[model samples]
Target: MRGSFLYIFGGIMDYRKTVIDKLKEVDSIKDIDIESILEIPKDSSMGDFSFPCFRLASVFRKSPDAIANEIAAVIKTDLNIKKIEVVKGYLNFFINKSKMMEETFEKIFSLKERYGFSYIGEKKNVIVEFSSPNIAKPFHIGHLCSTVIGNSLANIYEALGYHVIKVNHLGDWGTQFGKLMVAYENWGDDEKLKEEPIKELLRIYVKFHDEAEENPSLEEQARYRFKLLEDGCEKETQLWEYFRTMSLKEFEKIYRRLNISFDSYAGEQFYSDKMPEVISLLEEKGLLVDSQNAKVVNLDDYDMPPCLIVKSDGASIYATRDIAAAIYRVRNYHFDKNLYIVGTPQALHFKQFFKVLELMGYPWSSDCRHIGFGLVKFKDKKLATRKGDVINLEEVLDESVARTLDIMKQSASEVDDYTKTSEIVGIGAIIFTFLKKTRERDLIFSWEDTLNFEGETGPYVQYSYSRAKSILRKANFNENTPYDCDYLKEEVEIDLLSKLSKFGEMILEAAKRDEPSVIARYAVNISQTFNSFYNANRVIVEDKNVMNARLNLVYAFSIVIKNALALLGIEVVEIM
Candidate 1:
């Protein structure tokens, strides 16, 4: 395994390879001397490694089939390649199966939970801003997309060995807060506030909206209150602080259940003091221009709409605070990348924001990314908390749990402790349902689909695992018994093993794409394959050798299921 052969094999074996090695392999071709040609086949039956020989036909003065056969012959003689075949002018190489299986399993079992993780992002810092709910507003189904998407992105990056800083970016410094303060002052009730903080706050907010529709002065009053808050009015600041703190206490309960934590709660208010510096930097860069009595950044050159840095009333805008936040994150954390997990509606906002930073002559601004996702729409209508057309996230979680409990009661008659099982099934269902689809797609929230415990659903996967556990328990599998991989030669067994080999690649791909749905999809696939294998072939047979081998496979499946579930922020119980 020296020279071009070794380099090609090395590049194929490990995804992280230098370009020089790949080039060397390409240059070493005897007759053709091609630059590069490689592709992962569309299906497993097409072979693991494929290279198109059509390009080489011109150089070699022969037909593509001739070139493909020549390449196939060379690959067949190579010791690293177990087999080589030519199909439709393409050369396919299948590495030795046993060697690949052993090496993959060794890496997986040795690394355990950290098997798929890598240090490609070592020495890199990434700031992920997400879950930024407005203070005193109800945390509704709409907010769930951002919170989970952002949190999962942070987890994915951290797992890839990046220094991740999670920020809430709370909407604590907006005109809405002013309206809330004024409404509270006008129609404030102490006992009602204590009894139902969010409901009462929302009531006052709705009242302000309704009143502002009739009494135009109330709109101006709200703006004046916001200006005072911006000017560091003592009372306004006090009220903002109280509202933020109280709101966070409620938000924390949901965050705790979701297993999401932030490194900092640096919202708009936190970046207010840095706005002047941002404005000065913009002026120095000659990017700031006065437009309609407001400080604006003209981004026409970048084909983006103008960004308002300051309103006509001399109050800072969200874009200004975001710019300051970006600068502060780079200077303080020395982040290699800053990821903003906002909604797609704010796509233009980020475009202008990043464009402004680029105009300011920051090189790292080019690396800052905005991971935008589609909205979570319900069947009735799109979520609108302002109009009270919203479903509370807390209620969703509660309902998920209750539904799981109902299912558990219908099944599992021998269960003595149903409460614990219900909790696991319920929470698992919610998390899995959320992650089962592509992040870019808008999920139509359906109770029926979420509770459907069949066909690629979360409950189905959990039940498969439970079934495996039940079989293993009944067989009384002895850990001390010796197991051999040779018994794993059946088509079903090989299918499961092949999937197990792909776990590391799956995680790496998921992290790269910033989508946990990849892992969810893989988990479902593995569970289905394993269940099929278990059904077609007896895992706990009377024969000791077969039983031991099957038990080993089952144990391996359990490890993978648990690891994949953990990455998605789900817990897998031993029994369930």
Candidate 2:
């Protein structure tokens, strides 16, 4: 079911491939990887694709235009290449749009849900660790980036035939847990904790810090509690386990709302028992050093602060646990790539630990990646959990759904299931807003931009998809019936078909870049192009062949849009 698209779209995968094959014939550039240099023109008027002649000028000893013309002279028009134009020393090829439409529509109609699936990652393994919120803390807006980005990457990898293990490495072990325990014992309301675990826990946790500011000895008390936890004291361990259990329950509710699931819930505490083995290995490797009554791996030669393995209190630090976890994952999963979708602020920590792994003679340390993202801020204010200045993700999602429902009511749209549709749109709106921009860019949440039905937002994408579905319904599109692509001759129709065909290509690119924004931006582009096609031509035309072609195109668009959104971990509504 999954591999059928390859056989169907085989040679006619895309115009880019055709251009690469055609450009391979030019002797002067035969040594170069033509695919790397081939580029899509920013403006459609420039041509469908362009290759700069600037690089070839040095070899040919000619001006870029002269080289472009020389290359154009030999590469005659083929079945895939309709025409080649030289503009400002660039070789721009206009694709055979009719052939593209025929091949694209056939694959889209035949493969259905499996249209974008590829076999590039066959037999490969990858571990995507994300959405790892601290235990007993609110899952705030700041954590959203890692959650969606990691989930989307896992989805993208699976689409490309990689066995992905999604991990939520919960921050279940830390001094914070000790502080939370102290706060719970001192000021926690058991009734409130049962009613709202995260909220009540966060309240007392914040209060502990506030009081600790006045009572300096509270810090020592928190450390003592943490030492008890480390020493495996029965009471401390039980309380820790209780906190962890409650946190996981709360987290599961949020995960269900987002439609996300994880293969592993292993947190820092999972490595507590495993750390001794790692420290032993480090000691054997002669990597561990003494630094200010702590175990350290000096990285001064690499221009980094020494990675502290064990603190002065003999407690293992995050670096030590991370090293243990990486070793465990490699031995267990044998992952080709182990990606950590964390914040950019922790760049040094990852680099230091990964370097320590390398120094310890682990070659796979190079395969470990730190997929860092920028901060998430509400307007100008940054979200800080410690400061109690954070918005719960559930609150944002609820408001989004409410606003979407209000919008639907105001617009008086046909909503068969108002609750379901509103949730999809509202939740999807927040997810899309995070994904629409580059992950490295700090996100500033905006209500106006997020739920705008007409803007390039989640609702806009969902509505576009629903609109396409509506068109297919009106035209009575049938999957079993044959359709002709010959009648899809209008520019907008061809453009829409062109975008539809790139779905697989887009997925492959997203996988390669480790960026879900590629898929997000592509979805918006497809929606915008689809809208243009719908406005220009009516699908249910008087001409039978034309209507069939247009309807088939609409069906194809709907599938591609839905698949694109799915890759971003956003749900689509058939009617919005």
Candidate 3:
């Protein structure tokens, strides 16, 4: 709405609508809106915004390059447009430099720390189910992906004005608890159990599997004990609750270290009693079929396996519980979207459940999504929980923090609080390393690659934030003051401002796709860009106006980078 400039991303119905309206002069491009075809030029040389004319080419009966050139000629030079060009069938438009700096810096300086905030999802409620570690199990590196990714998504959705229900869907149900009880009864020690519950519990659970291999009858005993627990046998129920309590206490330590908070601790058990309602609904919808003495929803017509709802003995399985949970969540939270942060192995399972929901006549079933991430392998080998081959999450965190401390001691970056910054940097390094890749892509765990601070890692971004703060602190000017935007017209300065300008749009895109990697990549890029700008131009110059503008850029970079890092669940320290 500023009279002097056309704000690109932040402005509503401005330059984009203008371009779309002008492109309507070509009758072939009528149906396309700016959202559908607008893309940032992959190379900056291609210009600020690009519109590919390939789709319109077939209708226009001309080559895309020719159409692009015609469209470029059609768009007149306005106050907002510096020029338009045709680059290989893409209509790329460049904005006036002075206007870009003024709009970007002014918006960033005005928004300050709230640079990435948006109200796009104001009325929507999103339920994010993640970090569902099984009760009485040691927190392992296997659980890291879900915890960090899910928490980041929750933060991202909240940042975009969605009321996020951060649900820690603890895996506290199933026959596993029965097996844990059997192991605890046979090999458990009281004092050791109280001192190191999950470890001790895990030790005995592994022993049960080891012994069960020899004495196969122990497996039957485990199943029978599980049955009793399900039947609400008093002692079994009490033991299960005790294990859950002790395990939660241990898990809380890790959650606190990561600063993750959950709005709901409801696990599978919360929906245990509610499954019959789902089963009854399936029957009402004529979806329940008797297959091999089990209640199932026949999905063979859809080229999927039959979704078993109930066993021959009338016991429900995972799909049944999930069905009940979905119904419960919809009726309870009335969520616009339900996200399941799980491993890729369960893709079929989620698809099966979601299909069943559709068959049961839930119109909002399409809103459910499984944010499946690839498994984390140790030395390229899969880890087993029952076999005790997993790496304890606590151990990983402690070791990473210790390594961070050692690195800090060797470096000359004057960190004020070594202990606090080490924890932040170490945890951030691990999180950044995990998030740097696409969520759906499998990441190989390597200590050297993950902990490297020099590369595009969390520590690198954190260091950028710290460096920005340090630069601003040297001026003793934490307060924002209006400056002549014309002073920041250098190439690197404009590049930094352009990156800062796209921060909000990136957050919105990430939230829409449920991919935090977009913001993660953006954080690394902005950090690199700011570093380049710092190397090219000195911020502490003698010219007061130029110096203030540079300092504002530094402060803006620090705040935007910090905000992006926070969305990814990474914290920035004053120094590193």
Top-TM-score candidate index: 2
Task: Name every residue pair that clashes in candidate 1.
Answer: none
lDDT (C-alpha, whole model) for all candidates: 0.76, 0.87, 0.84
Model 2's alpha-carbon lDDT is 0.87
Regions of model 3 farther than 4 Å from truth: 1-13, 25-38, 51-74, 86-90, 378-387
| lDDT tens digits, residue span 63-146, model 1 | 888877765544323344566678999876665555555555565556767766666677888888888988898886557778
TM-scores of the models, in the order given: 0.91, 0.94, 0.92
- Candidate 2 Cα misplacement greater than 4 A, ranges: 1-14, 26-36, 380-387
Q: Is candidate 1 or candidate 3 better by TM-score?
A: 3
Query: Which pairs of residues have clashing backbones in candidate 3?
Result: none
Off by over 4 Å in 1: 1-36, 77-80, 380-387, 413-416, 475-481
lDDT of 2 by residue, 1-576 (tens): 324544535524556667888899888778887777889888877888899988878877899999899889999898888999999899999888788778888778778888878877789899999999998988876678899999999999999889999999989998887898889899999898888898899899989999999997887888889989988999999999988888889888888999999999998999999999999998999888998899999899999999999999888789999999999999999999999999999999999999999999999999999998998766623323344466767767788899899998887567899999999999999889989888889887778779875788999999999998888777677885567878888988888887787788788778788989999999999999989889988888899888888888888888988888999899899888
Instruction: Give Cα distance to truth, residue 494, candidate 1, Å.
Output: 1.6
